[model samples]
Target: MGNIDKRNRLDEAPFRYAVTKTNTVFIDYEGKQIKVLKGKEAEKFLKRVNAADSEKELQLIMAKITGNFKRGNER
Candidate 1:
């Protein structure tokens, strides 16, 4: 996780999330939608977000939820 922070500099918090009326979660990175969480997953994600202590922490959570976003090999 420290590596992730060092690589991405989540201090700027590039990740964002939105919840729908039906309790679905949409996670976005750099203004692009990347992942969706529904049912138990949505509930769990919301819990973690609500408990986040800071913007950087929230960004980390979102990044983890999005899985492996980039592997540094893109041309």
Candidate 2:
């Protein structure tokens, strides 16, 4: 996870999430919608996001949820 933190700068804070009235979660990166969660998944994600201590931690959680984001070795 340290490597991930190194690759993803906390200063930039590239992840963002929006929750709808219908309990749907929309996860985005750099202004692009990347993942959506609903039902139990959205509930769980909301819980985790609420429990996150800082923006950096929240960013990491979003990155993990999105999965397989750029790892800096693409050719």
Score each candidate by Cα lDDT.
0.83, 0.84
Q: In angstroms, how far off is 11's CA in candidate 2?
A: 2.7
Which digits, one per residue and each the tens of the lDDT, describe model 2 over residues 1-75? 566677556558888999999999999888899899999999999999999988888988898889876575422
For model 2, which pairs clash? none
Runs of candidate 2 with Cα error greater than 4 angstroms are: 1-3, 73-75
Query: What's the lDDT for residue 70 in model 2?
Result: 59
TM-score leader: 2
Give per-residue CA lDDT, model 1, range 39-72, as digits (tens): 9999999999999998888988887889784565
lDDT of 2: 0.84
All candidates: TM-score: 0.84, 0.85
List RMSD in Å for every model shown: 2.2, 2.3
The 10-residue segment of model 1 with minimum total lDDT is: 66-75
> For candidate 1, what is the TM-score?
0.84
Evaluate residue 18 in candidate 2 and report its C-alpha lDDT on the 0 to 100 scale. 95
